[model samples]
Target: MGKPISGSAADNSDVSFGLTLMAIAVLIAPLIDIFSKLAIATIPSGQITAIRFTLQVLFILPVVALRGALFDLTWKKTALHALRGVLLVATMLSFITTLKVMEVADAIAIFFVEPIILTILGSIFLKETIGWRRYTACGVGFFGAMLVVQPSMQEVGLIALLPIVSAFTLAVFLLVTRLVAQSEDPWSMQFHAGIWGALFSAALLYFGEGTGSDVFDPVVPDALSLVYVLGVGVAATISGVLGVYAYRAAPASVLAPLQYLEIVSATLFGWLVFNDLPDALKWLGISIIITSGLYIIWREHRLNKTAGTAPVSPAI
Candidate 1:
């Protein structure tokens, strides 16, 4: 063999920086959840979701201009971005609505089914292969989600289904992100996604006018509630952008498991901010969901290792 490669040092550095970005992004991500949960107390979840994407667009517009990529999008990319925005809007609307009734930790726990959905979808749509063990884990993961949702169903009726919907939509959103990330830069992704999200949500708001639907009803929040709304937007912008760059910098298998840290931070914030804690049953369910998800991630890593493939990480 030739001399061992020294240039691998640069690759290691990139992965290190990527992992750091992922950690910071994951830890701070729950701030979005917290802020949305707080904001929706006075604002409709739909309006709150709209404001997030709107502010993300406003916040990132300057950066995109500074990078000279503000006009880089092709029409096809524009359509893809719009689809991503719609799926993401659906994800946020569903999850935040769940927060209107469910505890942050619990809602997030149920939302943890996303990884399983993503894996199964990847197998079906991307033609990625899945073994029986991973399939079994996915089944167990869904069962665990039901364990958490069963109680919420009793307490809040069908409202608990929203998180499952959130999980499915988010999985699809991730699939799109994976596809788009191959060609589009992460900042452009954010900018276009925000534009589409803002447009779609505004359309919903307009159509919701006079419908008397609680979820769609717009509200002029008080000063404090307005602060919460702003917090939601800012926190989302930060997490969303960081997450995009983090994925851009690293392989998916290495970065995927870091997301579990979000649940940990979310639990802490939920307890500290809202004094909400998962009961034993919810905790058991959260554990199972996490374990199953991690196993799936590990299997992905092994397959990638065997094939010497580096999978792309998805954006926010």
Candidate 2:
């Protein structure tokens, strides 16, 4: 209520605060996979996906209502949101399926290919220019993903491809989200997407019932399973909101590199929760992937700084 902070002072404060939030978000992000992996033991991936989205909608709708943003959707915007949500559902379903058979760290390491894919897709669809160095980094990142995939393929068979599939789908989802991200608040955007995601996953579950598919068969959660399901929803909601706020407060270039911290959390949780640890070769791959990803983020930061372009929030 006194004087408001302004100028470079305010900017530095905001960046510092945003980074703190993003670090927390990165720490919390691994829990979603952990809970999903736990839930998948008892619940089918489809049902878990539906429950996750349903809980997100329930958690977000109240915020949207309070903000009076629920009635502002145009048809084009609604369709875009729906498309993004569908893509997200595909990504989650694939990821969770992989979680069923793979160690969480391995699955997450493979999925880390997303930033590379997002960069390529940005060049193709958004017409963003990428320098040769950044392109090389992307190539190296893919190689690192392959390193993780090779061992996982031997261990988990064809299921090793699921996280890669999820990465691609997630890249596309980010591309579409970029197109429609305008003046809408992040909470509102997430709320609408959650609604569509819940609907889409619900339909999939309905049609997929009795197929005897491990990924598609729906199961009624018992008391314990319900806790895991709720954990998934709660973790997702918190991390997602934190991500949005973090991006809003700082440049995506600054925040993007920090996201690699999730791999550390994934590794720790994998070891602690499931007693699963990546082998030396897999760890080497993870290091390479993290290096390439960090290089890409560094390059982006340099380019943005040199070009003096305003920072855009990345769709995580």
Candidate 1 residue lDDT tens string, 1-316: 7777576877888889888987887788778888888888878988988888888888888999999888888888888999999998898888888888888888888888888998888889988889999999999999999989998899899999999998888888878877888887778887888889889999999999778776887877889988887887777666767766666687868888888888899899999999999889888899999899888889878877311111111223
How many clashes show up per model? 0, 0
Tens digits of per-residue lDDT for model 2 on 165-223?
98898889877876777656667778888888889999998888999878777877899
Identify the candidate with maximal TM-score: 2
Clashing pairs in 1: none
lDDT for each of the candidates? 0.81, 0.83
Q: List the residue pairs that clash in candidate 2.
A: none
Q: Model 2 lDDT vs. the true structure? A: 0.83
Error of 1 at 52 (Å): 0.7
Native-to-model Cα distance after best TM-score fit, residue 273 in candidate 1, in Å: 1.2
